[model samples]
Target: MNDVVGALAGAVGMSHVIHDAAAMVPYLTDWRGRYTGRAIAVVKPGNTRETADVVRICASARVPMVPQGGNTGLCGGATPLADGESVVISMARMNRIRAVDGANNALVAEAGCTLAAVQQAAEAASRLFPLSLASEGSCLVGGNISTNAGGVQVLRYGNMRELVLGVEVVLPDGRIWDGLRALRKDNTGYDLKQLFIGAEGTLGIVTAAALKLFPRPRSSATAWVAVPDPQAAVALLALLRDRCGERVNAFELVGRPALELVLRHIPAMRAPLAGAHDWHVLVEVADALDGAALDDMLERAIAGAIETGLAVDGAVASSLGQARALWSLRENISEAQKIEGVSIKHDISVPVSRIPEFLQRARAALTAMWPDVRIVAFGHIGDGNLHYNLSMPGAFDNAGFVARTGEVNRIVHDLVAALNGSISAEHGIGQLKRDENARYKSDVELDLMWTVKRALDPHGLMNPGKVV
Candidate 1:
């Protein structure tokens, strides 16, 4: 281990290699603080060549390697194990925007570049990168690619997998595979870039990527609408799609409890509607042409929905500031929940049509099991994903409730399975959901995953005890 650390320090400056237990704490823990790991050292490589060199040293030493970017993962995928035998390869120093091809509608960004930086780079070229997440300011592009992250705009722009044109990865054996081609249609052989997109670094480490871009939207309309129930919210989505077509950008569902948490914990946040509603949705529509009448279209659609019983009350943002304020209410949910207390969070998704039924059944089953359990539900309902969380109001009981995470997950994930849904929609199967994933997946499916893992990382040295 000392030899390996010395080699890494030689490859990338000694300042970039940190072995001190105290200084490695930030890289050793996860964002949710549910996991804290130990490492021989945390290495920061400046570029792709330096990254490849560090990997070569670790591979030669037969040491396990964990590729981490930003360390903002909710799942403990980026965190090392407590065995203190692994080397965490932090990509934070590799942050760089290599190039922007305006004509091709693509840009190349290093693994360590923040999501916000990439968005800004695209905007400078008069194009748009539409992967918008609450952690965009701090999360890195490599982590987004590794997790195949999905956010609010997935309703229109799709997930990170769809947004990526190609990738540059360093294989487990220290060979660099430069597949960073910003081409739209390349149909010759296997789509190798996809193997690492959501593999969580089990196969290899992604150094950089060529991401797709889009025409910037010149006009957008946002609305906060109160619906009678989940079914109504689902219906409202369909109605908006029918009337507005592909202009619909985002449609988020927020439960009453979720909103109340935001209003209570998030500063200066108030309910959009005057009356206390059981459920609400934040809807957005955008177009490329300026003065495209998006507001009028959304207003007419909302009015029609109310008349037809799809929505009870609605408030459309008349200014950009108002639109941002409305969005803050949806974006601040996770932060508010965190401020309130620790809770068991499930990021699951079912078919779009079955979302309502899943919500109804999950709520009923949970309440029946624990009558006092507070259910805070919200997510990209437009894409069928829901952040269903559970917590007790009292601080004393909440700790005990968190201890029953396995029981709560069984209830929620079993229902998600019954509804033909996924246990993890956007978040990868990190250490947090590894057992649950194994429990839900079929033997044959698990076998195929293992096959891929063995084929790519035969030694199981790339991010051990994760995904597989």
Candidate 2:
């Protein structure tokens, strides 16, 4: 083990190879603090070459490797096991913007660059990178690619899987696969880049990527609308999409419980509308052409819906600052909930058409089990993904509520299965949901996944106990 550590230290500088328990503390835990692990060392490789060399050293020593980005993953994907035998390869020092080609509408960014940095690079070139998340300021592109992250803009621009054109990866055996092509069409024999984009570093480490870009939205309109129920919200979405076409980029739903948490916990955050309703939506329409009257179109659409009884009332943002403030109401739910207490959270998705039914059934079942339970529901309703969280009643404490995790998961998961929904929507199946994922996957699907995992990493040395 000393020889192996010495080789790794020699590959990268000894200062970059961390072995002290105190120094390795931050890298050993995930952002959610639900998982904590131990590692033999946390190595910081400066560039692609150094990262490849570190991988080679571990590959030769028959030791497992965990490729971590900004360590902002919700699942325990980046967290190592408690055995304290593996080495963590942190990508922080590999941060760099290799190139930007406005002609090709693409940019080559190193894996360690923050998502906000990538967005700024595209904006500098007068182009747009549409992947926007709450953690853009801190989350790295590599982790976003590994998880195929979906954020608010996913309703129109699609997820990270669509925004990325190509990737450069280091295989489990330390072989560099330089597949970063800027061309959109090549008639390639196989799309090999798709394999590692969402593999959670199990197949290999994503070192860099060529990401797709789009024309900047020159005009946008945001609104906070109150609806009678989820059924009406769904109908309104269809109506807007039909009237405004693809300009409707974001359609987020915030239930009353979810909004109340933000209002009660977050200071200076106000409700956009005058009255409280059971359900609300934060909808935005955007266009590439300036002076497109997007605001008028949005206001007209809401007015029409209100007349037909689909919506009760709404508020449209007249300025960009107002739009951002309105967005804060939706974006601050998770943080406010964190301040309140621990809860069992689910990032599940069902078909858009069955969203109302799924919510009705899930609520009925949960309330039947624990009538006083508090349910907080909200997320990207346009994509049918909901961040349904459960907390204890006013009378109970957090630990007592968290103890029902297993039973709650079984109930929620079984209902999702019956509705033909996915257990994990935007978040990938990491260590937190590895076994839960296996329980729902078909035998054939599991077999194929294992086959691919073994083919790419036969020794099971890449991010062990994750994904498959």
Candidate 3:
């Protein structure tokens, strides 16, 4: 172990290689604080070459390598296991925006660059990189790519996988696979870049990426609408799409319980509507033309939805402050829920058309079994994803309630599988859902995933016990 640490220190210098328990403490725990592990050392490589060298040294020594980014992942993808035989490769030192092609509307950025930094770079280049998430300030692009993170704008721009055109990765064996071609079209053989996009670093370390950009939206509109049920929310989404077309940038669903939690825990968060409704939809539209009559468009769409009985009540943001406030309510759900108490959360997705049935059946089944459990369900309805969460009823002890997480997960995940939905929507399987994934995934699918893992990382040195 000392020799392995010495080799890593020699490769990246003593300053970059941290073996002391104090220095390794922070990297040992995950963002959610659910996972804590011990590592032989935490190595910070300056660039792809250094990263590759460190990986090579570790591989040769039969030492496991866990590639980590900003450590803001909800899943334990960035966290090492408790084995204490792994070396965490922190990518923070490789922070650099390699290039920004304004003409092509693409940017090549290192793995350590925060999502916020990438967004700022795109804005500076007069373009848009629309992957927006609550953890944008701390979540690194590499982690986002690894998890294939889906955020608020996924309804319009898709997830991290869609935003990336190419990737530069260091394979598990320490070879750099520089497939960073920024072309819009390339049909040569297999699209190898995709394999690592959402592999959660189990296959390789994503060193950098060539990301796709879009024309910046010059005008925007936001609205909060109350719907009778999930079906009505889906109908409202269809109405907006018919009226506003591709301009519908975001469409999030906020359940009454979720909104109530925000209003209760998050100070100064007021209800958008006077009375409570079973469901609420937060919609955003954007366009490239300034003074593009977005307000009128939003008004027309909302009015149509209301007239058609799809939306019961609505409020369009009259100012930027109001827009921010509305978004705050949606974005702060997880934080607010955390403050509320221990909750069993599921980041799930089904087909857009099947969302209504999923919610209906899931609610019925869960409520029938656990009558007192509080279901605080909400999320990106446009993308058929929901942050379906469960909290203890009334005065139950939070810790005791949390102990039933496994039972709750079995119920929810089984229902999700029945609906042909993913147990993990935006968040990767990571360590949190790996076992659940195995239970839900088909035998053939599991075999293929293991096959891929074996092919790329035969030694099982890269992010072991994650994903496949």
lDDT per residue, candidate 1, 235-297, as tens digits?
999999999999999999999999999999999987889989999999999996464488889
lDDT of candidates 1 onward, in order: 0.95, 0.91, 0.91
Query: Candidate 3, which segments miss by more than 4 Å at Cα?
Result: 394-396
Q: Which candidate should be chosen as best, given lDDT against the real structure?
A: 1
Cα lDDT, model 2, residue 202: 96
Backbone clashes (count) for model 1: 0
Worst 10 residues of 1 by lDDT: 288-297
lDDT of 2: 0.91
Q: What TM-score would every model get versus the actual structure? A: 0.99, 0.98, 0.98
lDDT of 2 at 214: 93
State the lDDT at 281 in candidate 1. Answer: 96
Higher-scoring candidate on lDDT, 1 or 2: 1
What clash pairs does model 3 have? none
- lDDT per residue for candidate 3 within 102-173, as digits (tens), equals 999999999999999999999999999999999899999999999999999898899988899999999988
Q: List the residue pairs that clash in candidate 2.
A: none
Positional deviation of residue 165's Cα in model 1 after best superposition, in angstroms: 0.8
